[model samples]
Target chain A: MAALGREKMKQLEAQYKKILADYIVNQTEKNLYIAQNFTRQLIQKNISPEDVISIHKNAIAEIFPDRMNEAQPAYDFLIEVMVHYGMAHREHQSLLQKQAEYEMEMKIATSIQKALLKTHIPKLSTVDIGMLSVPARKMNGDYVHFFYHRDDYLSVAVTDVVGKGVPAALCMSMVKYGLETLEYAYKEPSYVLEVINRVIEKGVDDSMFVSMFYGCLDTQRNMFSYASAGHEPALHYNAKQDQFVALEAKGLLLGVLPNTKYTYQEVILEDNDIITMMTDGVTEFRGNDHLNSRQIITSVIRDNKYLSAQQLCQLLYREIEKIHGFDLSDDFTVVILKK
Target chain B: MASKSSVEIITEWDIVAARQLGRNEAKALGFGTVDQARITTAISELARNIYLYANIGRIEIERVDTETEKKIVVTATDQGPGIHDIRKVMEEGYSTSGGVGAGLPGVKRLMDSLEVQSVIGEGTTIRAEKWLR
Candidate 1:
């Protein structure tokens, strides 16, 4: 009987050794099964949970030498904790990958938006055209387009969408399409707005709208016909009168109502006369003291009426920037047409 | 009187913006994950058509809520050359640009309702809607 008991003890010791060896060698499901069975045997042999935890820590150290310095509690926690940690690490890696992909997409989108705002200005001999557009953010909601329809008619449009960023930029692109397509068929400012309003009403959502100023210069007749769709009034500098007049044409904002009627106002331009059309960013700029910005714009045009169109535009922009300390809160756009 | 939003489609990047915005609007309207994906895909196809055929266009998304159910509406309009044969364009596997030809028809299949109006020399407007069941 003594020999049989000693033999049983020896077999149990051999079985435990084999289980630990198998767990260290492969760490597979079969190894896990063996370890579980060995744990039960240890419990049956009156081994304390503390002793089991120590054994597990030593085995883990053998498998992962780099983790030997890690803090380990004396309690016998579930071995599945290690598997959970592995899975969490993998999930973190995948999340970082997805974040990188999103950043790349945003970068590409920003570049495309920037390209859309870089429009080409047309050159005309009869009138000097000066324009500037600066976005508060990476994407601009302001839009301007010049169409030289046949050599006799020069059409220029300036538009401002209600919002900013990607959505606003997208709305501006629609305005571009509306202007291009309507200009092909109509030259009258009111007719152009009528068609563009219909297009916007059909496609634009109620949450958004656009304010636009469309003007056509008949070079032969020296007549400028313009219409406003709830946009800021254009400033006209009469060289002979030596005064500023606001060209206020009334119409509803585009996309607000269908079949909206817009009336066009015509102006006869004399030599050295100037017409300045700007978005609200200029007229609505709040200085340090909340000074009236519209008055400042008018004064600037009145003071710089003698300068060339390009010089006057730069001067006005500089003055506005100086007032805001070079930090503008909105997108700024100005189109200056001088005869 | 649903909440509405609009985006312009000029380049390929605008198409991505439209898709993303559409998905967000649908989600805001309590659309399911499958419905959001479907709406986004339809926006992608419509925005791409604007860039391909019209050179420029606009897309509008709105959320409609009634006493019975909720719905999301999307409208796409372009002043480019309009479609000649509306019936053929709506048919599956009919493409004028050598593509898979599943654009308009695929959008129709994904949405609950689809309406298309085209003037040969003027432009085309397409409106699509999905209802949350």
Candidate 2:
């Protein structure tokens, strides 16, 4: 049995030598074929080339049992395969690393853009606000922010950038900057929106627009002045009437056209009156009975007018949760100001 | 100068206990002033999140070494509901659990550095550092 095994080893060595001789004639082609075959075989058999090489090397080591003298060719072949495998593995790992780096950069950029757009609410004497937002997706173009430049007046605005994901986020950032710039450029609500519209129109592509509701609250005077650029209606919950009322201003959305004019409306908000402002994320929600978002919100407010702004927001969220069974289609934000 | 001046506590998955632990630690670390109330608030927020989200968790408190620029490091770990969307979690007002969506964001605001690691169905670890000096 030992004699026959030696003969078999000699024959296998001869076959290996013949294959090496054939490979030596075209080294590049042979190497290319080896790589391709390795990949194909790995995919086909769900096995790793390294594992195959390891098993082969271990078998040779057991049979010949000598590092320097016996099984040297097998050892050399294993080394070559390992080197080739390492290079291929390194390339594959590097490709994955590059993709991860690209994704990381995208997230950082998106976060920076979000930071620019989602400015925290500025404290003002005119109002006590309870605001909450829950994005239904990774990036929502919905924006809610406040600016208090003057001591007696504070400006609150909510805008929905006209898309979703990263592009919408970028547009929202542009609108935020435009609003900040408009604060310096103009003061009246209508004119401020006009300047913002021009700024965004110059900055954004033709496809983009912003639906906005902007208002200035005068606490001492108990008056509220606001303008709308084709945004969703603002809900005015009269503490006296104990009902929710929608306030609409007639105007085109910002960036829809160059030099579009906006209209301003004025109202008196006395003690304990509530003004609820929101994006379409609240009004456009679909419910279990397939009721549109507007009906759902109106019904919720009608049923629960005694709840605080924060409480109302929570109730609305819970109702939506029940309606969609825990799926939200857009970013939801609601700001309730109690006077 | 005292290495063991600060006390540490580990408790079961009770959100109330975690909040108490956070407040106690923040006070022990010398942030008891009313102006710095947010520091304790942030700590409580993080601890509450961990307790509510995980079945088991741990909290460690160490005195801010004045020699090391007076930085306090607070870490919260949990083995439940690994944040599959960390980026979203970090975003302001984004919460899967019923909250103002302010836990992570508020903690980030209070601390100088915030690092989080989470795996789906595995676990989550949050590290927050607040500068005392």
lDDT of 2 by residue, A149-225 (tens): 65577778888877777888878877777777664533478988888889888889999988888887877787888
**Stretches of candidate 1 exceeding 4 Å from the true structure:** A1-99, A287-289, B1-133
The TM-score, computed over Cα atoms with residue i paired to residue i, of candidate 1 is 0.54
Error of 2 at B119 (Å): 49
Model 2: lDDT equals: 0.67
TM-score (all chains, Cα) for each model: 0.54, 0.52
lDDT of 2 at B83: 81
What TM value does the first chain of each candidate achieve? 0.72, 0.69
Worst 10 residues of 1 chain B by lDDT: B93-102
Docking class of 1: incorrect
Candidate 2's TM-score: 0.52
> Which candidate should be chosen as best, given lDDT against the real structure?
1
Quote the lDDT for A232 in model 2.
Answer: 87
RMSD of 1: 22.4
